[model samples]
Target: MATNNLINDMIITKRALPLFRDTNGFIKNIDRSYDSYFGKSGAKIGASVNVRLPNDPVVGDGPVVSPQSIAERSVPLTVAYRKHVSLGFDTQERTLNVDDFSGRYIEPSVNNLTGSVADIAMTLALGAANMVRNVDGNGNTIAPTSETWLQAKAKLTKQHAPTADRFAVLDPDTDASTVSGLMGLFNPSAQIGQQTKTGAMEAPLLGVREWINDQTCLVTTTGSYDSAATATGSVTTLSNAGNAIPGQISSTAYPQNSVIATSALNGGINAGDVITIAGVNQVNRVTKRSYGTPMQFVVTQAVASGATSIVVSPALVGPAADGSQNQYQTVDALPVADAKITLVGKQGETIRRNLLFNKKAMTLVTVDLMEVNKGVVDCGMANLDGISMRTLTYYNGTDDTLGTRLDVLFGIGVLRPEWLCIVPDIVDAG
Candidate 1:
């Protein structure tokens, strides 16, 4: 029969089997695998190493050393376990326990194993492209129409009324060209009447001319004048040289130069002929003025007693040459107006980020697992054992029966086999 002391020792030793080199060695192997798999630059993917034991204890009232005393005094060696495991830069570090393999780790690893590096790289590239396509500098998604120029003139005209002069002609000759260019920037098919349909109908009629000088003069359609008092009935007698017969006529009525009079005083004047007394100015000069200010219109309908004599409250007339022409013509006391472009929000940037993150995460996880699987198989275990040892095998029993058994043994510590199986060649089903 087995001694009670031996049975107790056996139990203790059996319990301590998990704490042996096998358990700690497995962790160390995992750490090395993780580092080699994820740590391209020699940084370990496993958590920081933490020793689970305190310093050596001091002995008091100790006797001479004996085999039993030594055995009793011997301390079990502590295990240095990795406390945290880093998945990647974007994710939070996960904590690990003794004999604890996370399903989360397995999923990431399987994803890495089955995934393609080239495909992953392509996905990341596409994602980055998507993100760049959607955003502006202010963290706002750029709208399709955000690049358009605001129609300032149209806005002002709509708020106010259509007037001959709303915008101050910066350069009257080039103003149309400037507006056309601005419109073309927003729309390639932009035209004067097409894009800006809100402006005044008579706006194009406004023109600029140089001001000669301020002077009053008469304008007559008739070429020459004649006197009614002349007796010779000759055209030459009525034609006056300078200072010939200044203001001798009693009435303003005069005669045309050549009149075929049937009876002199009672005869009618010929059509297209005019009469003017001597010493009256016979020339009229046209006046031109500067129209430098902006003007808005107010429409008002007028009522009249007769059909032809209606008095419109806001009468429409030919624009006068000067501001002093009429009180209604001058647009001096008017309020200033302005316009702006409104931008709407879009989801271009968000879509881009999501696409990029998903593609990259999938790729990285796949590559990591593939490398890990390769390493595990290289360590020389059973073919089915290699599949069972995979992290994903625990969560998903997709592998064969042998794989399931190996997975169970590793997870539950039921079979503490020391042998590690090498991985066989993996054939792509695709």
Candidate 2:
């Protein structure tokens, strides 16, 4: 009858943390160094931490101290997501031991929360500039291979992504397909032996730890605009007279992080669709050397039919010969006026987004939640390996029920989009 007779909040909190850590396959590999900043109280949604960007070195003459002004660059990692799972328990359920209670309640709560976080994090994948299509040049989707993974790695290497802590996450079907394709290639070694025993790819292969993540994104259709479009104008300069120029210039109102085109986008551009403009090649992050591949842009927002403009992510920043461009330069050159626009796949096609990246490419930050000390409930919060979760158990006298809720506050950020690549496969139908 008393609240004290309910399950131990502290024990539930502790058990939930391990379940959360072990359940996620994708978010576990992302950078979580920013978690330390949000461990305190009053850390609310929209709270942000600046991730410092590396500065370019200046070649100076003979210690003359000709000081070139340095501009500090940073990307904001903001806490903008809040999610929770609440469950009601009967009297008998509350008296169970910690393990029994955890397996019955806490494990499922943590697993649901984990999948929610991974889904939210997948939105950041749209910002990736490097895409290794499972489809061939003739534009038909195929199964992924070891060479597919290697292509993703090569893309990251060209962008100068850190070689260590790399990962590749595939959908279950793609994982099975890739593993089956790789089963006959390697000698009978421990890595292969482990995979063979598990009937799946569990070991690191081709410089990346492979994972099967059901949360991997799948898009059923892209933009339906079939014919090629032409850029109405050009992104002439990064800025004019120290003032950052808006994407919309003059009467040609190009949306921010978007392109203004001359053709009527019939079905319009859809979110998650990949597109490229002729002559806009990708460049290395450090050297700014052209990789000779057209820079890929993923649509981040939907545009209406007959619209002349479309939105995209990783805002176009063309490279410069001098170090005059912004530190976040993304492409070798801007689209010239009338540059041809080409979509990657057919108008309506299924795409499974399998991701590969360096750990620094993405970041996930979790923060401790504020307690409800004034409420008539038992509350406990726990932090483990940069993750914080809280459990609240309360009694409802009307229905005579015990309710427990688990809550998590977190944020996801795309740090180095160049370091993130998508190895997409077709989501085959039955």
Candidate 3:
């Protein structure tokens, strides 16, 4: 029972759970999340921010005698919800296999949790899709070079983004492909090499601190956005979109994927599936729907599948018009009708992403779900930078099923939407 005590004791889990640090892929080294904890004590579990900060006043010469008072600005703090994704497992004491349990149960659950966090953080960088002005005017591919670094740093500087603690999180595949050529440094040996364990490059270079974050930085194909021929050019509401469900490709044209309203998957695209059309030279993997823009795919709001048409991530980039010529074809495989499509792959590839940010852009916060301190970090009940793993044996009254759960609670908040820049579709050689 001594070992049992170790697993059951909350204190032991709090202190000793750290021994499993090396096992975690992304959570351990997320600098921004740890650094951006807004010190709000006893805040609610769900994320909601108050934005009463006043707009910058016009600068002028000081009054000779009396000073003019600007009108009192009273504004409401906009509150946004934090997405919570958890993974856990159950074990029966009598037949519990501790040796392999870690491999089967704990690792999978923890890995999912870590991966979810990575995905969440990545959405921040996805902001590039909608930037008022981006590094590339078209928001498409760019060959890597030191000038690329200068441009990225310049964007932040233009935004008046703080010069300190700034970072450029690179898409490993894109960076490896483009950065080297731009810097004129050829190290073929390191082409597409394995990303760092923390998913970041080791050194800071150029004018700003930089990181190669393969785990969280997303590289997705384009999705079909507008279909003028359809009754509705685009699906605006989530419900009409069928809660963003999986949509099958209706047909595929050579060198290009489906043409919206023409031959798109009638219906069968999963929300999280990373799919691509087989025949097209420029492959597209749909991520999510564009909330406002008809043709641009940006928003991540879940819309279940419906019969009309499917929406995708990185907003599938297609011809200007339905009958337009397919200009994206390559010598390799061209998309064919009903070609096989794979969901988002784990490896880095065509899509590109770079998140340059400071504290104002986004804030990450972790709270103890089980304890009732609300959102306060009081006792060691919930460790901030570390994870809290606990075991609970329970049964549901309905089916008498017994299970155990070990989960985590965390959130990445895009507080100041304008403060960050998500540069995607760059060509780099990391």
Candidate 4:
């Protein structure tokens, strides 16, 4: 009898084969170890798994795998299979398995770099304000308000008095008529005119008779000169020389024998100077003016039975004629500039871009002869699915006058969170 030809049949040896009870079960298990092997034929498998992995190997031919061994290998196996998956589930769940049977969870940690930016901004603002309050260079203790800082400026100027000196002349021998006539001659406006007699005869007329007496003398007086001279030959002068003259002129007009003295004037005080007057105690006033005129004056003169009015004089120097006469005034402190917040990155842009581009290729893959498989694909696609990450950055600049940094972040309202961390290239505590 002729048997049916069996062209494609052959005898095979017995060997252990990996198998699962159900198709879904096999697919899930194969996905967990995607980086290793799966299927009926020797081909790479593609599927996604949500898990963290170990640095070491999991499965091999030399060792019998235990439950503990499987537990330890679960991480690597999950990471390996984190990509290729069917579209039956949600996007997030598809790449990141979240079923009750899928053993994995997600946790978020603080990004210190982001938190640091916020801390720096707050600390800088406080420190700047404190610095402004403590500054005492010009003894101006009051910190300048926003109005003063923005709208006003320090200025210097000169001052003047209301009254000045005049001069007069004395001629002991001249008669009253002669003196009067001479005074008329010195008048600012005196003119000669024609004189007409009863006959209408006109002739050259002499101007108002003004002449210096035979003996002329000069005298200086602070008070107004009398127009009518009491002395027969004395002539009073009404104009001054216009030049500065320094000398002591004796005059019988002032009160004599009655003492005229200046009370001891207060001088510049040091950091520690204290005094008590009229039942009031005061610290030493900083001496702002030394020469020129007294900006302030305190009178201790005694009045009726020990009563006196302490005269207070507040004289502000007037605007100066030019820049040369400008004087500098002292102020205790001034407001300073604000600080800045910034961001930085550890890796270069090129490297980051490259990693992002090939994110899919970095994924895990598994192969098996029992089932069909595909090689490695995008790692991020396997792990993150539709989610993508974008890098952030920050930088700061300095402010000179206030020894602070420019606060660019808040100005733009970009920096909001309070807690932040920063990693700096340099640590300049000083």
Model 1, TM vs. native: 0.13
Q: Give the Å error, residue 301, model 3.
A: 11
Candidate 2 colliding pairs: none
TM-score per prediction, in order, is 0.13, 0.87, 0.50, 0.12
User: What is the alpha-carbon lDDT of model 3 when measured against the actual structure?
Assistant: 0.39
Candidate 1 versus truth, CA RMSD in Å, comes to 45.2
| Candidate 4 C-alpha lDDT tens digits along 254-361 | 111011111222222110011112211111123323333212111111212121111111111222244112122111111111211000111111100000000111
Candidate 4: Cα lDDT at 421 = 12
Ranking by lDDT: 2, 3, 1, 4
lDDT of 3 by residue, 1-430 (tens): 1233123324323432453343332334333333224344334444433332234332334666544455332212211223322323333432344434455555555556555656655654443322221235643455445565566566555445667766666666655644445333434334224322333344455555545455566655433332121222321222111111111111110011222222433233333233333333332212111112122222343223244444333334333244322222111232334443332222233445556665555544454445433432222344535443343344555765544444444444443333455555543457
Model 2 weakest 10-residue run by lDDT: 240-249
Q: Model 1: per-residue lDDT, tens digit, 106-213?
A: 334333322222222222122110111123586443221111112222322222222332212121222233344445444333333543663211122122111011
lDDT of 1: 0.19
Q: Pick the candidate with the highest TM-score.
A: 2
RMSD vs true structure, all candidates: 45.2, 5.4, 13.9, 45.7
Model 3 TM-score is 0.50
* Per-residue alpha-carbon lDDT of candidate 2 for residues 1-430, written as tens digits (9 for 90 to 100): 2333557777888888888877877877888888887768647887876666677544455857866666665566678788899988776787877667778888888899888888776765655667787667878778878887888899888878888889887787787888889989988898888887887777567888656556545545556777567777544322111101121111111112544454566667666677888888887666666789888876655667787776665567775556454455677777777888788777766777888888888788888888876654788998899888888888788987778888888877666666788787886566
Worst 10 residues of 3 by lDDT: 246-255
